[model samples]
Target chain A: MDAPTDQAPALVLGLDVGGTSTRALVATADGVRVGAGRAAGGNPTGLGPARAAAAQADAVGQALSGLDPAAVRYVVLGLAGGAALPSGEDMPAGEAFARVWERAGLSCPVEYQGDALIAFVAGTDRPEGSLLLSGTGAVAIAVKDRAMAARSDGHGWLLGDRGSGFWLGRQAVVAAMAELDGEGPPTVLTGLVIESLSLGGAVPGTESASVFPEGAAPVPASPASSASASPAGPIAAPIAARDLVTAVMSQPPPNLARLAPLLATACAAGDRVAEGIADRAAAYLAATLSAVRGPAAATPIVLAGSILTNPTPVAARVRTALAERWPDAVVTPALDGAAAAVWLALDRFGRPPSPAVRERLFSVSTAS
Target chain B: MDAPTDQAPALVLGLDVGGTSTRALVATADGVRVGAGRAAGGNPTGLGPARAAAAQADAVGQALSGLDPAAVRYVVLGLAGGAALPSGEDMPAGEAFARVWERAGLSCPVEYQGDALIAFVAGTDRPEGSLLLSGTGAVAIAVKDRAMAARSDGHGWLLGDRGSGFWLGRQAVVAAMAELDGEGPPTVLTGLVIESLSLGGAVPGTESASVFPEGAAPVPASPASSASASPAGPIAAPIAARDLVTAVMSQPPPNLARLAPLLATACAAGDRVAEGIADRAAAYLAATLSAVRGPAAATPIVLAGSILTNPTPVAARVRTALAERWPDAVVTPALDGAAAAVWLALDRFGRPPSPAVRERLFSVSTAS
Candidate 1:
């Protein structure tokens, strides 16, 4: 609770609060990181208002330890569900943060922006660019002067999110279901998904008899297979496919997103069905970017989110697609969003970081 | 419950239980309907086991009024979500219905089948055919000897159900959102959806200034427009599109299925956006049918579900697409699934119905 004095150095705080995690960082105006903290999901719309506020406070408080919060001149919060705030509210997140600041006996100005906007800043110092993100959800936003000008496909997991992690994972399950139901070609993904989900025991009535005909080739057993090999069980014994379905149905619906990486792994291992899913996901994401890109002929496009940051087949495909369209478009990967927020906050003080400063901030913030 | 008399005439009962409604019918072997009743949604997987069992009991009890339960020779249930039964359970729906029958003193055998199977029976006396159903959800199943042989795309609303009512409605909302955000072309749906949802008041920060630039054509006002005409409110006032978004977001996620008919209505009225949704929905359905259609060149294909039954543009498009592929395939509409189930049950007693009997049963069942 040290008060700001002539001896205290001015610093900036940057926060990235999302549905899955929250991150906060304090840095000097020159983009040198001073402190950093992390917390669980803090998206208000996803994790109610009170919890979201508390998460942000916890992350910020941890980041501000051993430092004078009063010396923090600017604060920028990049929030995932910011756009979904009730319109009638007056700077809700800001007010909540103000109370937190008061409790800590610190004063500072706070600015809130969409997660996509901060993600764009995270990739590059350019104020204007397009960002294509493919995390659990997928979206592309056209940013101008550090503000969102247009967007495509952030319609949650149901209606759109075409190329998102959720979409890819759901596609893998669909393919597996089709294969098990005898309506689609046999895929390596079927056995892979069964093993990954640990669906060993069978459920009655959904026997493989219908899926695998009398003379059809038997399903390949997984290396880690736990299912009984003997066919001499009771007539009413469960089927492997039925067990897989049960395993999937037992989980909360959104947990399906966890399967995306499995699909990526399978694709890398050369499974045709998995490869197709990855290709289609990348295509969908590329299309989303096309829909939201600005009219500027050579606007830089930043690639953000877990799917894009990872060196997966889908990410490779997306990079190739964007390269074909915008040969000169700077498609940089965003390593640390908190670092991006730090740079953005510093920009508010008319000291936008140079390339060297940006690199230093990214390295320092991501290192901790 | 009425006791069976030595001289009581034997009859069969048929029940069509769905997610929205349940219907039961008692009829003579000659297709003469004696009684009928209806109740709320009875899909066990959709409504859960208890509510579904209760719905079936209510509908069947009402249909059996004064009839002797012991005289009921057989009972066939066309159940939605039937295939999704957990395999380990013995006589899944049967055991549930048995309790109801025991209370009512019914002593007759009961058979349970998927709704698609009954819909196929409703369309044709032929034991083998394909049935394409597109209600709140959509699926295409191949039937062999009145049993489901193979299926395609019944992956519920989240994973698949591409050509379903839910799909169409969700597509409409996606389009409206795009138009509102100035990411897509202008469409009449923007106004219609707003008016239908009655989202009149403004929300802060979402003024249409960015969406509809100055001198650009004004958005077409709906016939029931309630938005302010002045267009000069507080700078923070909400936009009409924002209000529409709020209205949609306020509802439970699955309620998006309710918006499908509005899309259909708009399509019938020649809205391009709606028309596109209908055409795509039909095309997807046709593809689904093709996926599950038997190799037998002249397999009968039955079209069921509200989207197909209502004579909408989507049905017409699907019919055209299906007809072009299977020129000799018998494409029949299902009007009374309960009656169809009764006919199938009667066939179990060595009475495969004649065409005239089918017509009589449909007419009698639908008449009420």
Candidate 2:
């Protein structure tokens, strides 16, 4: 092992590389940590993993400043895209830390693995734990006796995600549009989507530069003139990440546990046509799990991600479904995923920290 | 025999009822002479079978007014939503006509049959011909001799249509929206959809009551007012019948055989997305046909509806698939559906007319 550059015994650094967000946590080894410090940003893999990993390093390094650099002993980096060689061999994750460590003049030996692996570790700390992550992107990972197994349901949001925040958000948008056209079952999200887009501007013609920039260049001659011609909606304008959240939130039924209230208020008063999005969503997640782990892989499946943490009814439905599938497996509630990242990293290094250290590292109070 | 309502040669009247339009035609006893008349408004059950029959009677009455009422011996009405009875029994479709004819103030003998029955008759005139209809709605009808022997599918637009004009058009809209959100493969249809909506005068703030009455209610007061303030795009609206024609016209490749030049131009510019959509549509239609009548059904299948008449690439693809599947069965070019309706109606009374009357009645110039 490389010489432990950081001497800190209390803090264990956890890195979670997701398709959508890359989160880092510094916490005490024992699972009950508040938060030493946290760093959040877009997934480096999506932004081009190499550059994103470098950016992540900068962010992580900035958060670690003024801390006991020598005290830090173990590092756990879990990647969204598993670090598997093209020929299926194991390889180090997309780590820019070596370069970062050289620049910072600090050396901490970092163990690299897939994000699913650490999520499994963080959720249950058992080899047989199953971890599902539904953040900016979606993925599920399972580990048993050090034998790692995984499956990618879709190519993220572009191709498919089946059941994730982005998937639900996208489906909400589709349901909204379909409802607008009087095609599919009604959804409350239509109003929300319409509102979110209007914040940007009118759609289509208004986003000439952003949408069909190459095609619109010759038509306008002036950049200012081109912008003015576009429509006033997110379709025409650049959409923010928060808008996607809003879109997903506004689609669930009221009784649903995931995020149904958003869909309920609209549907109950009778203006909302949000379909049974959560029901379908729960089914999708269950189906994906069953497909991979033998319809009866009934390990304690840990639900992690904003979707699982949804205050609405989706969680309840998911719990109910899992109960039917894995009656014996316990359904654990979701904590802050970033915090899970931290706890996972600590557990990864083999020295689970004390309770006090965990309390000092986790800052869940400010998370939401 | 019942007294002939018209003094023209003994003939039967066939009517193909649709959501937006209703077409009627006259067919002679030989089962070959078919011609189209006017398109009326309203559906069978929606208007009540009584009212629907009256509308059909009026359309047929005016079209054959010059001929002797006594010459028209039997009237066969192939009505929509008349496939199976409420109890799932195969009942004579005459209930629809009797209800309509009684309301029309005439007691002329009328036989009611499912639209698929006539479509099958128009396809082969044999007892067991397979007829596939790909209109705004879709269904398959197979007949053995005069008996309606079998039928495969008809799920309507909401639950499923599998392959139909409505299905294809709706798919086009979805693909366009997906491409807009960068969620799916891109297609030239995005610009087309946008342009089509713009042409429909879709603007922000003022919800068009004429378009969507359900959502036309005043935008509700909500914290997310910003998202709902904007009006939906016209393209995002439920596809209209005319749009279906445009969507159909925009498919088929190589020589641009079926689609408009603009669509062809976009596809030629290396638009794999649009190509994928077109290819999928072709596959869907072929699959639907196979599902209804097995790949090796004994009857020579008739590809009815507008999708077949035009020399579009999608249609060609459907033909190719059918040929590949059957190898031995004959796939006839689509006959004008309304014309087939006319022939079916004439044949129902066992009063087939000469080919001259068929040509004149089915002439496109006589549509108005």
Which CAPRI category fits model 1? acceptable
Per-residue error (Å), model 2, residue B159? 1.7
Tens digits of per-residue lDDT, candidate 2, A1-368, equal 24345554556666665544456666555544323333444354335546665656655665466565555556666666521201113333334546655564446666666555555554554557566655444555555763366443423433234566655655555554443333344343544454443334322223433332332222212222222433454454444322333343334311112322344334343332333666777787776566445556667787766667555455667778878878877666445445655665565566554555445444353244
DockQ-based class of model 2? incorrect
lDDT of 2: 0.50
Total clashing residue pairs per candidate?
A: 3, 84
Task: Quote each prediction's TM-score.
Answer: 0.81, 0.43
Residue B281 of model 2, lDDT score: 62
TM-score of chain A in every predicted structure: 0.85, 0.67
RMSD of each: 6.7, 23.0
lDDT of each: 0.73, 0.50
